[model samples]
Target: MTAFPLLDPALCFVILTTAVLAVAIRTVFAAVVSFIVFGLLMAIAWVRLGAVDVALTEAAIGAGLTGVLLLSTVARIAKHRADRGDDVPILEGPEPDPAPTDPLPGLATQSLAIVLSAAVAAALVAAVALLPVPAPGLVAEVGSRLSETGVESPVTAVLLAYRGYDTLLEIVVLLFALLGVWSLTADARWGGQPGLRHLARPDGVMAYLGRLLPPIGLLVGVYLFWIGGYRPGGAFQAGTVLAAVWLLAVMAGLVPIPKVSGIRLRLALVIGPAVFLAIGLAGYPLHGAFLGYPPAIAKVLIILIEAGLTISIATILGLLVAGAPEERPS
Candidate 1:
């Protein structure tokens, strides 16, 4: 029995150790940085395991996008601390510290959480190490039939054509998450000057970089979207990259967020999932199953779906970063 070199057990052991150390450390910044490294290593493991598509997604979304999000949150929190003159208020109003009580209950809860996580991890390891290989038997059959489908990649074909419903549902899940986030901060107005006032300055290196980056990002995003049918790129991947550039522009005050979301913004945010669902429901009558594409127009439909999804995803991400119901230029 042989293990994939990138997926070597020893490498995984090292990753787990590093993650544990990061989590146990008291420094929030260190923990956030470690998570980013963990995401990159996970991508490497995926590539080694012969899942290039997943690896690309992990690298783009897990490492790149997530790291930015975490850093932004950290920056905001740090600024808040500075404004408050302290990170935590030590029971203000001259209240005396309560008599120290037994720490047993907190200790018990922490111990329980640790034990349960350890048990689950051990079980997962045992299952992976002991289970017989199941995918090898099916992958050969799938690969052989790949040519029969118009899509070049088996993963693409399966995701876009054979199991489109799953993709459709996943988009719905994304929408719901956005809605949930919106709900969480419903009353909080997102538009105002960010703590980084220098970001609004126009004459510095930041302005120069902001002026230069968006067009390049747009081209790269379009290229990724077009090439995804046969390559590692896709709508979701492209959208995230594009969103980051958009976010940069917003942060640098080059592109001001609108106070009220315009018709175009609203449309872009909903069009992808709406079109996908409409097509899926329509396919039941026309194609005999939900999300089943017609023979002559399947490729066209997939492209259309991907395009809508890309716009929607990018808009949602931008809005998330804006953290406002309607962002107005500062």
Candidate 2:
């Protein structure tokens, strides 16, 4: 029904090819690069499917933040190997030769893996094929009650109003995950700045972009949060952008990594979920239901919640990528 029908099929093919390459690639870095490409392609597919909110989230978190995290991991692994005098190249070329003691998967194990993968693929195909024609969904229901949610964007409304509890839990999960990472820090390094301090030449491209991009990125991130009330932009995407901006600044040596124990840093990490929970509790007194916003000021409440969430999400995401503390506090 649309122009350029071939576009969808072509995109799908590329996506599948990239996915295969991501898993089949010999080098971890190459596979990660392929995975990032696959994520970006998936974002494009989401856009073509008329899910712009999903597309933004996919591009920002799935491709951008996740790719950076994986690359960081690769760098760390390479550093560790070098420290141990392993002579293994983590990012470039093929993996180091396997130790003679290392055993490859046996023929039976490989066969079982192949069979399981095929079974899973067939099950997924069956599920899609069995989906009802016209595919039952809550589009109409969400539309009818959209105004009451105090957001013009259905995706925003669903995330912040209708399924707010789930969103809250997701934030909490991120916090917990970050805590788990922090717990991995050495006792001597506890409460110290996260990851390693980055050094870059002041005249280099990274330093130049770090100086140039933050102001623009800050504006865009805030705009995304504000526009979410009426469009396909929201806290998650905005936070990811802000996180990337922060990471860039740090990597360019424009800003120092904050101590994990810093009061302000800790506050920024919890403020979002705290605000959401506070609002939810207040709703019990105001509307006899948790997370219920009073009709008169629902929009104001939602905006407040999103603003807090944006800050916390950005902090948590940046820290997640920076990883556990590696240096003792000064």
Candidate 3:
């Protein structure tokens, strides 16, 4: 009744070659594009391995969000360079001869890297293709134990129950990364260009698309979060989508940058990690373990943690995109 899918060795070769070439390229823009391609190929690889959740995550976060972040950083760096007069325009007079480039570090460095990468990849491939499957794989065991953990999917069970501490730490890592970026931004002035000017309401196709798209995006994002426990959808993906919606709203001039970052904003930003850590600590007293939600209420706790994480992540992303503090409108 069903047809089986065959693996294409040629496709695998092409993808791997492309990934290597992308890394080898010197240009930042080309490298970014190549990385996005690499992520896409990796998503395909995940699908081939029958990992739908990983594939979705790779597509959404790896390829989509990371690409946007890279482009944003590039634009910011370009602007900074222009402001500092680091880049000079070429004159239209006679074509000037190009300057000779200096040699990179050393041959040993490149050779060492190449050898190491080749050896590692070969070893991994050999292990996968040549080694026999273990009698009782850990994956099967975990899947079987999912019911005891109050999670339907093995992935969810592992993330929310068996290894929840790691997930909690990951959320903290996101928060820390956000804080680090904010700190590195320093006290520089944005010069009144809040980056929201381009999002102005205008009469044309742009306005029509803007009006039509955000509602649909919001709906999709909410749906993803609601179904995350049962499906591939999860807090990280939903938060990113919600952040996109918030950014779109700001760009459309529907929501201006709020200058009054009083108590509320701070609380929203911190509450997610705070509540998560508190629950983890509370678990130690109740269950003699950290971040171990009781089976009776584990599902609800997971949902609640995800909700907080989504809100915090979205808010941080929006603020980072806006280049807050310096550009906040009074």
Candidate 4:
């Protein structure tokens, strides 16, 4: 019998190599960079798999913002080490000596991990290979009912109409996660400035780039949101772009961070989820089901929700990367 077709040769090689480097690299900095590279590559894989939404998400959040966050943390950790007199630029744990440890994973643990990984991979391959040709799916169902949601994009229609609860819970989960991050703050630092205070030179490349990038990024992000009503982009993906721009400016010291306890900041944080819940509640009285909207205004309501979610998501993502506050609660 003929063997099933193999995975893409070049993509497979790169993914495997990156996967190894991400885990096997000795330095934390190298590992993080490797992981970021891996995430970008995975985004490409998602594109190849015909998932534009997943691809956008993977690139923006999984790769872009995550890389920034790790780099920021690594920089802080490195600075803390250097402040204690170590002159090396290499990344290790929070120690000054910087003595190197074993670069490889333990033999037993590595073996077990490899075995589990291979088993899962094989199972997935076999499942795909054995799937019936032209397997039944929800595509027709989605397409047929897309009109009911009053949205042009089937993905958007399903997300806001057929599965609105899932999206609502997702927003709540993000806010809750941020709350957990805040919980880690020292009591005195509650509501203080979040993340490290960057001090970029006035004429520095970072400062210039920070000033330059946000305008373009903001336009692109909003464009994504605007087009998402009938395209692959959406609030989450667009919000990630906006969040990244905010982070860039903050990291370059082109902007200041506000105290988390500020009423405006607090309001910004909660507005999206609050609006979403209110809309859902209104649905019961107006449309007879939670999260339901009048057929005539379904599209408009969805857009309104997306707009609010975009703002909230951008703030949340930026703050989450900024991590817990570190100064006095102002």
lDDT (10s digit) by residue, model 3, range 1-330: 214333557558868887887778656567677888888888888887778888877887788778778767766666675688864322212223359777786989999999999999999999788867664457877877777766566776777677888888887887777666556443553222235345465765656666778899889888877787887777777877887887777677666655424567667777778878888888887678888777788888778877887788777666666653556333
Candidates' C-alpha lDDT: 0.74, 0.93, 0.72, 0.87
Candidate 3 lowest-lDDT run of ten: 88-97
lDDT of 4 by residue, 1-330 (tens): 215345556777898899999898778898999999999999988987888988999998889888888887888778886798866665744224436876888899999999999999999999999999899889999998788788898878877778889999999999999999899999878878986678788799999999999999999999999888998999999999998899889989888887888888888788888888888999999999999899999888899888888999999998999889998864
Clashes of 2: 0
- Candidate 3 ranges with C-alpha deviation above 4 Å: 1-7, 84-132, 188-201, 259-262, 323-325
TM-score of 2: 0.94
Each model's TM-score? 0.81, 0.94, 0.80, 0.85
The lowest-lDDT stretch of 10 consecutive residues in candidate 1 is 87-96
lDDT of 2 by residue, 1-330 (tens): 778989999999999999999999999999999999999999999999999999999999999889988988888889888899976687876897666885779999999999999999999999999999999999999999999877899998999999999999999999999999999999999999997568899889989999999999999999999999999998998899899899999999999989999999999999999999999999999988999999888999999999999999999999999999988988
lDDT of 1 by residue, 106-170 (tens): 87899999999999999999988988766345567777766554666677777777778788888
The candidate with the higher lDDT, 1 or 2, is: 2
Order the numbered candidates by TM-score, best leading: 2, 4, 1, 3
- Backbone Cα, N, C clashes tallied per candidate: 1, 0, 1, 0
Alpha-carbon RMSD to native, per candidate? 5.0, 2.1, 4.5, 4.6
